[model samples]
Target chain A: MLAIEDLHVWYGSSHVIQGLSLTVPAGGAVALLGRNGAGKTTTLRAIMGLVARRGGRVRLDGRGLESLPPHRIARAGIAYVPESRGIFPSLSVLENLTVAARGTGWSLERVFETFPSLTERRDHGGGALSGGEQQMLAIARALMTNARLLILDEPTEGLAPLVVGEIETLLAGLKETGLGILLVEQNLAFATALADTVHVLGKGRIRWRGDGTELAGVPEITRDWLGV
Target chain B: MLLDPTFLAIQFLNGLQLASLLFLLAVGLSVVFGLMGFINLAHGTLYMIGAYIGLSVARSTGSFWLALVAAPVAVALLGMVFHVVLLRHMQAASPMKQVLVTFGLIFVGLDSVRYIWGNYSHGIDLPAVLAGGVSVLGETYPIYRLFIIGLGLAVLAALHWGLERTRLGALVRAGVDDRETAAALGIDVGLAFFAVFCLGCALAGLAGVVAAPVLSVYPGMDMSVLILTLIVVVIGGPGSLKGAALGALVIGMAQTFGQVLVPALASVMIYAVMAAVLLARPGGLVRARHG
Candidate 1:
C-alpha cells in the first residue's frame, strides 16, 4: 500500500507536479492515466525521491518515504521501472538481472519463468535485445528486487500488439499473486481491464478517481481530462 | 642488420619496463575518467608527489624499501585530501573548468615539489639486494628494470582481479555506467567518487615511487608522464583496463623500436599510433554501453 498527499514538484523554474494526491490499497492494482505532460511520471518520480525539488508526503505501508533516497525506498519494498527502462546495454541479460538480484522472493529462475523470452536471451547483451525483450528484461529486473510495490512507467510502450497482450497476461498473473502495481499508462482500455482503481491526471492534478466500473460512463472526463 | 640480437633483447626489455610505468599512470586515469567522466590533468602531479616523497625518505633513511612503502602511503593521503577539499566541489562544474582547475593544480603541485625537494633531479639508488644485474640471452640487464616490470604486472593483475571479481567492482562498474541508477540501487555516489579518486591517485603515486630509481625525480616529470599517459589512454580507449595495457605496450614497444630503427621519429610514434587507432574506432577499442 502507498499514499501520496499534496505533492508539489518543480524542475527548475517550471512546476511539474502541483498539489497532486492519490493512494493505492494493499495488494491493489492502480492505474494512473494521463495525456502527454500531465505530471503522471513526475508523481511517480517524486514518490521514488528522484525529483530534485519536491514538497509533500509519500508513505509506503503507512511509513514516511519522502525523505529517503531512491535506493533506500527500493530496499524498503518499492521498485521503480522508469519510462526509459534504464538497462545497461554493455551488460548481458543475466548480468542485468544479477546486478539488482537480491536473495528473496524473486530469483533468476523465477524471472525466467515469469518472462520466458528473457531466459532464452540470458547471455545476450541488453543492447542487442529487441524492444519486447528489453521491456521484459526491464520488468524482470524490477522483479529481482522482490519489492512489495512495483511502480512501472509505460511498460508496454513501443511494444508489438502481441507482445503487449503477453505483458497484459503477465500482469494479470501477477495480480493473482496479490502484488501491488502502480501502472502509469495511456491505454485506457488495457488499464481498465486490470486496474481495480483508476486515477486520471491532468495539468499536475488528479481530475478523477474511481473504480473500473465507473470508467465507462465518464466519456466527458476521458475526453476533456485525458483527451483519449 | 641494424637490430643486433643483444641490442634488440635489451630494447625489448626496456620497452616492457616503460610499458609497466605507463600502465601505472594510465590505469588510474582510466578509472577516474571512466567512472566520473572528469579529466583530471593533475593526476600526474600525484605521481610527482610520490617521487618527491620517495626522494626525501630515501635521502633521510638511506633505505630504498622504506621509501617504496612510505611514498605511496603519503601520496595517497595527499590524494584523499585533494579529493575531499577540491575535486568533490568541482564535480558539478563544466569539464573545461575542471580541466583548468586541475591544470592549475599541476603547476601548484610542481611548485610545491620544487619548494620541498629543490629543482635538482634526485637519483634513487636501488637497494643492494636488487642492485646487481642478471644475464639474459648473454646480455646483462639491470635487475631493477625487471623488478619494475614484475611490480607493474603484479599491480595490473591485482587490479584486474579486484575490479572484475569483487562486489566492489560491480558497484564501481554500475556507478560508472550510470551514477543515478547506481545511487538508486543504494550506492552513495559521492562517497564512491571520493574513494575512487583517492585510489586512482594512489596508483599514480605508486607508479612514481616505483619509477624513481630508473627515472630521474624532478619537477617536470609530471608533465612528461602526463602527456604520455594521456596518449596511452586515448590510444587504448578511454576507461578500458585492457585498452590501457595494450596502449601502453604498443606505445612503449613502438617508442623503443623507433628509437633504434628510426631515432628521428621515435618521439612522434605514440601520437601516430593513437591517430591510427582513432581512425579505426572513434570511440576507442572498448566503450561502455547503455541499457
Candidate 2:
C-alpha cells in the first residue's frame, strides 16, 4: 500500500506537483493520467527522492519515506522503471537482471519462465534489444527486485500495438500476484483497463477521479484534464 | 624493422615489463574514474606510498614476500581512510573540485613521504632466490622483471574473471554504467563506490611495490608514473579493463622502442600517440557504451 499527502515539489522557482495527493491499496493499480508537463512524473520522482521535494508526506505501508535516500527508499520495497527503461547499454540482459535481483522472490528462473524471449537473449546487451524487448526487460528487472510496490513511468512509451498488448497482459499477471502498482500513463484506454481507480491530472492538480464505468460519461473531463 | 628476432625479443620483453606496471596503475585509475566519476589526481601517490612501505617492510623483515603482502593492505586501508575523511565530503561536488582536492593531496602525500623516508633513494632487494637472471632465447633477463610481469598478468586475469563472471562484478559494472539506476534497483551504490575506490588504490600500491626494484623508491616518482598512467587511462578508455590493457601495451612499447630509435623523443612519444588517438576516436580506443 502507498499514500501521499499534500506533496509539493519545485525546480528552482517553478512549482511542479503542487499539493497533489493519492493512494493505492494492496494488489490494486492506481493510474495517474495527464498530458505533457502536467507534473505526473515529478510526483513519482519526489516520492523516490530522485528530485528535491519542497514539501510532502509520502508513506509506504504507513512508514515515512520523505527523508530517506534513493537507495534506502528502494530498500523499503519500491521499484521504479523510468520513462527511458533505465537499461544499462553496456551490460548484458542477464547482468541487468542479476544486478537488481534481491535474494528472494521473483528468481531468475521464474523471470525467464515468465518472459521466455529474455531467456534466449540472456547474453545479449541491453542496448542491442529491440524497443519492445527493452521494455520487457525493464519490467522484468523491476520484478527482479521483488518489490511489493512497482512504480512505473510511461512503461508503454514508444511501443508497437502488439507489444502494448503483451505488456498489458504482463501487468495483469503481476496484479494477480497481489502486488500494488502506481502507473503514470498517457494511453487512456490502457489506464482505464488496468487501474481500479483513475485520476486525471491537470496543471499539477487532480481534475477528476472515477472508476472505468464512470469514465465513459465524463468526456468533458477527458478534454479539459487530458486534452484528449 | 621489427622483423629482427633478437632485437624484437629484447624489446618485446622490455615492453611487457613496462606495460605490466602501467596496467597496474591504469586499471585502478580507470575503475575509480569510471565508477565514481571522480577524478583523483593523487592515485599515483598510492603507488609511491606502496613502494616506500614495501621498501621499509622488506628491509626490516628481509622478506620481499612480506613486503608485497603488507604494502597493498596498508595502502588499501589508507585509501579507505582517504575516501571517508575527504572524498566522501566532496561526493556531490563538481569534478573540478574533486580533481583540485586530489591534486592538493599529491603534494600532501609527497611531503609526508619526504618527512618519513627522508630524501634517500630506497630500493627493495630482490629475494636471493629471484635475484639472478635466466637465459631465454639466447638473452639473459632478470627473473624479477618476469615476476612483475607474472604478477600483473595474474591480477589482470583475476580482475577480468571477477568483472566478467562474478555477481559482485555485475553489481560493479551496473554501478559504473549507471549509479542512480543501480541504486533504484536496491543496490547500495554508495557502498559499492567506496569499495571500488579502495580497491583501485590498492592496485596502484601493488604497482609501486612490484616496480620498486627497477624504479628505485623515491619522492616525486609519483609524477612521472602519474603522467604516464593518466595518458594510458585516457587512451585505453576510462571504464574498460581491456582498454587499459591495450593502452598500457601501446604506450609501453612505444616508449621502450622510441628510446632505442630516437632517444631524445622517447618520453614524449606517448603524448604523440595520445594526440593521434584523440584525433581519431575522441572517446579513446574503447570508450564506455554510455556517456
Q: Pick the candidate with the highest TM-score.
A: 2
Clashing residue pairs in candidate 2, if any?
Answer: none
TM-score of 2: 0.95
lDDT by residue for model 2 over A3-88, one digit each (tens)?
A: 99998989988988788889989999999999999999888888888886468799999999999888889889999898888898
- Looking at model 2, residue A62 earns an lDDT score of 97
lDDT of 2 by residue, B196-256 (tens): 7788888988899999999999999999899999999999988788989999999998888
Instruction: Report residue A116 deviation for candidate 2 (angstroms).
Output: 2.6
Worst 10 residues of 2 chain B by lDDT: B282-291
Residue clash pairs of candidate 1: A87-B291, A89-B290, A89-B291
lDDT of each: 0.83, 0.88
Cα lDDT of model 1 by residue, B5-55, tens digit: 888889999999999999989988876786677789998999989988888
Q: What tens-digit string does per-residue lDDT give for candidate 1 at A35-143? A: 9899888888888888899998999989998888877887788777778777766567887787766648788878888788888889888779988888888788888
Scored by DockQ, the top model is: 2
